[model samples]
Every structure is written in C-alpha cells, then in structure tokens.
Target: MSGMSSTQPWDVQRLPRADDKVFLITGGNAGIGYFVAEQLSGTGATVVLGSRNPAKAEVAMAAIRSRVSSARVRAVRLDLADLSSLRTAVESMEVDRLDAVVHNAGVALDAPPRRETGDGHELMFGTNHLGHFALTQWLMPLLSTAPAARIVTTGSFAAKSERLDLDDLHSRQGYRPKRAYGRSKLAQMYFGLELDRRLRAVDSTVASVVVHPGGALDSLTPSRPPVHARTTGAWLRMAPAALLVHGKHAGAWPAVRAVLDPSVRGGQLWGPRIFGLRGKPCREPVWSQLTDTSVAARLWDASCDLTGVDLGTIPG
Candidate 1:
C-alpha cells in the first residue's frame, strides 16, 4: 500500500532496483513500455522486449544496450492480435524460465464499424484481453519453474465504466468502439484476479497482479472517441477538471511496482498515488464491486472457452 508522494513527480530513474531476474515486457519498445524495459534492463535483469514491430523493438533494444552495455536483453516478435502469433512467440523463446511477464501490450480501434479477430471475437477484446489470456496460459510452465513469477497486466481507470456484458461479449449486438475497449480492459483485470484464484487453489508458485497505468501516452490511443475511452481532447473540451489529473508516466509506475514491489499481494490492484488516475505506484481499490468473485469467475470460464486454453490444466 506504500507509494511515492502524490504531490511529487516521478520518472523511470526513480524505479526500484531489479536484479537477477528475467522479465518479458510486452509493447516494451516505445513510450511507457519502452522506459519500463529500459529501467529493468539497467538494473541487470535479463529483459526481453515483446514487440509486434521488429524494427521498432530493435531500435529500442539498441538504445538500452547503449546505456547499459552489459544489459542482457533481446527483442522477441509478438503480436497479440493473433493467437497463433502469441503461441509462436512463446514457443520461439530460448529461455528456460521467466520471473515476470508484463502484459503491457494493448490496442484501441476507435474508428470502428467494428472488426473481429479471426476467432470471430471483437478486435479490441481479442488483442487486449483474449490474446494475453492465451499467452499467459501458454507460458505457465516456464513461469511456474521460476521461484516466483508475476503476471502484471496493464489496466485502466476507464475500467470503471466497463461491464462484462456476457450476452454481447463480442459487442456484435451493439458495437460501440469505446465500450468494446473498456470491456476488453475489464476482461484483462478479470483474468488477472481469476488467474490468481486458480493459481492459489492449485498451490501454484506463480502470482498474478493487475496494475493500471491510470493514464498514459501510447500507440493504443483511439483515433476517435470510443463510447467511454478517455482522451486528452475530450478532457480538455468537456471536463477541464480532468486536466488537473496527469497520466504521463502512469504506465511506468504501476508496471514497475507490479513487477518489483515485494509487498504486492496476489490479485491486488495497483495504480497511481493520485485519485486513481495518475502519479506514483500505489495500491488502489478495485474500481468496481462487480469485479468480485462471480464476475471474475464467469470471465475466466468465458476466456477459457473463447481461447480454448485452460490455466487450471497447467502443472504447477
């Protein structure tokens, strides 16, 4: 529950030291994700950047190497939009085990008449939630091998506005760009909590933690407002009060805390120290009471059904 002061500014340089562990950070080649990779790599951890774009990943890796010549780092191609790509990426890794898998990759298709993945699920839901769900399921063995493994998912405050509409999960019944994005993120959080429960029940060594960046600048920004997608443009126009809230490095803080905080509890949520929007890493309340047992369990079952993957079957 401890964190940096809410009134103070924080950056990657202030991150806790991480040593002698291996970390795989998705979307780690740019922006907040990039900085997270850089910080962990600097601390002498074996850092792998999970990137969809090879060239961009390479560039980011090169920069990190320049700063820390001994940084044991590499870039692995990973596109969460495709489940096969997720499987292939994990399969391709030569490493024996991973200490943490930071689910930092996400996307928001705001300009939408609604698109679905190859599996016929909504695009946002596929890439943001289902894909990561599958990836985590696939990586259980390697994660279980490590002394303590953490699955740190990047969620959002916008999750407050999202509900897992089981009747219309694909959002085909009513395709709203923003709503789909929120549902996808909410599902990600659901997966985090449910996965934790499953791991505990099985006495698995690995732990699952859900972290929200609160707000951040990233490639996932929607071109147009999804039903409830938060954006600077909207905040600036409709709600000036939101401007007082900052999200610049919200992604970096929660990610660092989730991966590094010894105090982080399984199934606990972390975000900025501020009013749940932005600041330093800190334990925060789950945004919705609906994210409790019934919802998380249902989402877990639905995820296993949708992705055709099961976390429970994996050996501890």
Candidate 2:
C-alpha cells in the first residue's frame, strides 16, 4: 500500500521515468540483478553495473541493448572481496551524482570448508556486508550530491532466522555454510536499517532502504540470450515452485521499487506481499529481528572498525 491515488496498482512493466538520473547496481550481470538492471534501464536512466569481470559485464550490456532500445548502460570493475580496490571502483564511475545504488551483489557459499576473503574475513560476511559497507563510504560524496539519492540494500529472506555471533565473526568455531551466509546477509540488513536511522537523525537527503527478493528461481525467469537461457525441462521441473515462489525477474521488483518508488521512505522494508514469499512488492512490517536497535548499532560499530570507513561523516 503506497497510499497513492492510483486507479491501477504499481506496474513492474511501467516504471516512473528516471531520465538524467544515474543508478548503479552491483552484480547486475546475472540472475536477479540482471533483471533489475534491465528493468531500470527502461526508465531511460544511465545504468552502471559493478561487475568484477569486464567481459561478462559487456555481454549483459549487449543483451540489455538488444532488448531495450536506447538503453544507456555500462559497467565498472568491482571486486567486493578486496577492500583495497573499492575506492578505485567508485572512482571509475566518474559521475557527479549517484541517484541510487543497489547493493545487490553477494557471495553465497552453499557448502564450504570455511573460506576467507583476501582480507582474511569470512567470504560471505566480507563481500556481502563489509564490502558494501566500505563501498557505501566511498559512494557517499556522490550520493549526497543527488537531490534525493537512495542506498538500496538487497537483503535475503535467509537473514530472517540468523543472529550474528560477534565473538566468532570469522566463524573460527562451529562454521556452517548456510548459517554463515545467513548471518552475513543479516548483518547487511542491520546495516541498512542503522544507516537509515543515522540518515534520518541528520535529516540528510540520502535515504537508505532495505528489500528482499523472497524466493527467486531461474526456472520461472524469462530468458535474455547469451546472458541466460532456461531450458524447457528445467522450467517444467521447477514449475511447481512457482506456487510458493516466482522468477528472478519478479524478485527484482522489490529492489527496483525500493530504488524508484517515490512513496517509499527510509527505514522501510519491502518484500513480496503474499506470505512474504511471492507476489508483487509491498511495504512489509520490519521483521522483529531486524528492528532490534541494539544489534544494529553493535554491528554498525564493528563494521566501521573493520572497514576503516565511517559513514558518520556524510557531507551536508
């Protein structure tokens, strides 16, 4: 419920025109992130994708151009695991203002012998949480320059059930892949909320919003050739999953709405409206776990200490 006086509901196909605005999406080369970038480019905005691989980024950009005529799209080299490269990644954008940034890139390890990032931090936690934490610091100057810049963090439903064990942040003990991944995403969700609180306290023009792509499966996703293609058998095999989940294309809606929806406010959580699993995007209540100010604050401090980048100093 956006509480807007619209005869029709929000249409994923028809987004509000964001011409002249510059939007950035990390991991916009594949999966749900690709769809998010594709849909956003339709609004006539210059979409910059943050990808570690230039070749893959070019392929995704080519696919977008073929689908959407007059699409303005490009990519920058971004490797979230390496902290030292983040400043250069932000610098490569070369834009005076950033209208919005979707922190959609993440590293999810399903099974692992507990790997670590280049910085010796847990891979999932470092890339998904700390990488984004540091990236936001570098992007702050450009974000603050926009009239109403937005920081949209793409969280996960897995984050709902996890709690951070600050003592063993690197998972030196009792390391499970799923648990570690969930905690990493949980930290990201916490950061988004904490950042929103801080931004609100300062009355800054920048807004930090959080969103989750409930259950996006490739079986239900539409194809963008060369970038991705679903086989008929795979679609049939996973068709039943659609009853409870939707395609990755649909999953991009929540994050897309968070970025472009004017009615959305800072600190709000958007997700699938039906059972918080599958449906169109809607303003969902903050999960009780996510609303904990204490955890959010603690995580914020730890993130700052680890990243050596403070979000506390956003230019006025």
State the weakest 10-residue window (summed lDDT) of model 2.
Answer: 1-10
What C-alpha lDDT values do all the predictions have?
Answer: 0.77, 0.91
lDDT tens digits by residue: candidate 2, 1-316: 2233344578887788888999999999998899999999998899999998899999999999999998999999999999999999999899999999999999889996999998989999999999999999999999999999899999999889888897887777989999999999889999999999999888899999999999888889988899989999999999998899999999999999988888888999999988888999998999899888998988888898888888778665
Shift in Å, residue 255, candidate 1:
1.1
Model 1 root-mean-square deviation:
5.7
In candidate 2, residue 37 scores what lDDT? 97
TM-score of each: 0.85, 0.97
lDDT of 1 by residue, 242-284 (tens): 4435533345778887787666778899887777766677887
Against the correct fold, how does model 1 do in TM-score? Answer: 0.85
Give the per-residue Cα lDDT of candidate 2 at 195. Answer: 95
